[model samples]
Target: MSTAVRRRRALTGRGAGALLAGLLLVIAANLLAAPILLYVALLLFLLVLFAVLVVHIPRRSGPVTRRISTDLLTVGEESQVAVRFDLRALRIPHGIWHDQLPPAVSGDATGEFPTDNGTSIRYAITGVRRGVWAVGPLTLHTIDPFGFAQRQQEFGETRTVTVVPEVVPLAPLSSNIGAAGGTAHTSSTRLGQGSDNLSPRFYVSGDSMRRIHWRATAHRGDLMVRQEEEESSPDALVVLDRTARRWERQGPTADVAFETAVSACASVALHLVQEGYGVDVLDSAGTVLGRLRGHEDDRDGLLVALAMVRPQGEARDIVSLFDGTPPGPLVLITGHLDEEDAALLRHGGASAPILLMTDPLPGAAEAAARLGWSSAPLRDDIGAAWEDALPARMATGGGHVQR
Candidate 1:
């Protein structure tokens, strides 16, 4: 867009060839005493001057309307766009065009087409990384057929592309949670007379005629009454560490480790949601970024939230993340496994925390080993790893309470 750049592009490839021809003309004229050589040099100089003018002249491209298949996408999925340019009654010859693309996107952003036959430009966009990115306004560099000059023009407006994290079914925790014919983390209590789909409930007094279970009353010969509501603890609580420092290997830039951490969290969160659990994604400061309440909640909403999460570069208070929650299974996802970070898992109010990391954590592992807590590597292939690790750790019996 700068004047300097426009001036540079104006130097067409054919202009150089023409200049060469002019030089040869002058040489022959000098040797043969030909007067045409002077005219040839003049012509070459005039042509070069014309190129300069062509670059400096303001050129506006035909009005264009932009169309993208979608503005929202999953990390591994691809989206595409088509731009329609009105070329009717237009004087544009052949032009090279380029659309601005985000760094996380993979594919060619440039294209070339003659305006004589068509008015559309199309490109496919795939996101290899997760995050919020800016996708475009278009820029054009057009070349004249004579090669004497070029024209530069830019049009359209920048658009945002939100790329959410990839989600896969999480490895099931080795417990009765999966056996409940639903996702509740623990074995359901006795089904109460009320609330739909009872997961084992407790019997209470003051039972109404409609509230009492007739089948249970007949079996026990007493008024079998229960609250239809299920206990909340049997549900899983997933904690994510968004501290800026923990995910960073360098300054604010997060490496693949952080990405892995996010993917791990997303996979686990999606799994829990499917199995019927609620997930609250938070930062190190306990700042609530988003939540997904099992199958009852919007699945894409959670992924969209996860897609926008970025490393905060602060030390997240991992240990106390579940300080006041009704106890159940606690799953924490982070990059490196460290003692302080692991402490959140060790001391969390739950019976024992299930610590999952982007990769293997020796310090955390040793801590988990000694404390009898369930801990394991969280990887790109998280479902398989979780499926493999959960049972062994549970069978070994996650350590006894220290508090």
Candidate 2:
């Protein structure tokens, strides 16, 4: 409101013809000694001055409120964006109010709104891209009774809408081999399937001896036991390569490769979270963007983070990303593979690490294969390389998405 008040300024535009005509008439009438013409010209001049004065004062308008169908929206989906004006009994007979909006929400009418009981206007807006955008600061276009002057006033605060990435269905990385009780499930599983579902608590004095987790006791140097939490999701770590290195043969931005890569990341995160998995999303820099599990809040946050992530540089630090990650199936997504990357994954402790390449590298896939990494190449039909990375049964029509 204060910003609007400070910005308010009087603009005398578009009524010059009549002002010129009145000035000419006054001079001509004075030369011709016509009192009636002279009187009319003087009256017209005075009226114009009065209108300008009226338009300049009280520059600030009333408060405005905006509402969207939902604050959380998906890319390519349409939502109604509406704004309401709290017109508190101002005698604005012929004025139009316009709200400034982003191009994504353009095409809505920003004209005169009703003032009798307050007015609201709505537009159907579809988010073209994923990211957060602000919508706000209402502007009022007020016209005087004579239609000769229009005054502008601004009101209201900024509102934000988050457009999250589209979550497409993707088959689990491995069906018969990993994560869930399967062939890939090792005997010495450090992270238990039960702990993901059950909450572990500090051991109390009366706890049963068998219930005490010796492993937790060894790790924590104190007795610990599992406690029941209504529901929890399994943990899954997704490593994304953000290095500006070559994914597709493109410039610095690498728009095409980045788009496909982001889609792949989003797909993986969404699939894991929806299917009762806590996903730790990390970039090449080992920056943990989101640790989203099946929880409602985690799911929402993961999608939004995926939508805005882009390649920062080459994701050369593989070992750094492994730090603090709970034992889980690892999915490494990268533009290309190197010897160092392959060596790191070989002994990384992930029984069968899944590798998704954004593009088909000449020898990178083979290098990873030699080290026993499941390699999947990027394809047009496949939204992400992970689709092809899965076993045949889980990759296509017969696969189960869980949720």
Tell me, by lDDT, which candidate is best: 2
Error of 2 at 115 (Å): 2.5
Tens digits of lDDT, candidate 2, 232-284: 34556777777766454445332655566666777777676655556678887
Model 1 ranges off by over 4 Å: 1-7, 20-32, 43-58, 87-89, 116-118, 181-234, 250-254, 294-298, 313-320, 339-344, 359-363, 391-393, 396-403
CA lDDT, candidate 1, residue 4: 23
Worst 10 residues of 1 by lDDT: 1-10
Tens-digit per-residue lDDT, 1-403, candidate 1: 1112233555667787788788888889899999988798878878787765655454454566777786667777888878776643345556787777766777676888555634688888888777787666667776655678776666766777788777776545445434442344443243442346542233566546566666776777766754456444244556677665566554434477777777777777677665565555665566665566544335666667777777675654555554455445567676666775454455344543666676555577766655556667766677655654463455656532211
| Candidate lDDT (C-alpha), each | 0.63, 0.64
lDDT of 2 at 234: 50
List CA RMSD, all candidates: 8.7, 7.1
The weakest ten consecutive residues by lDDT in model 2 span 181-190
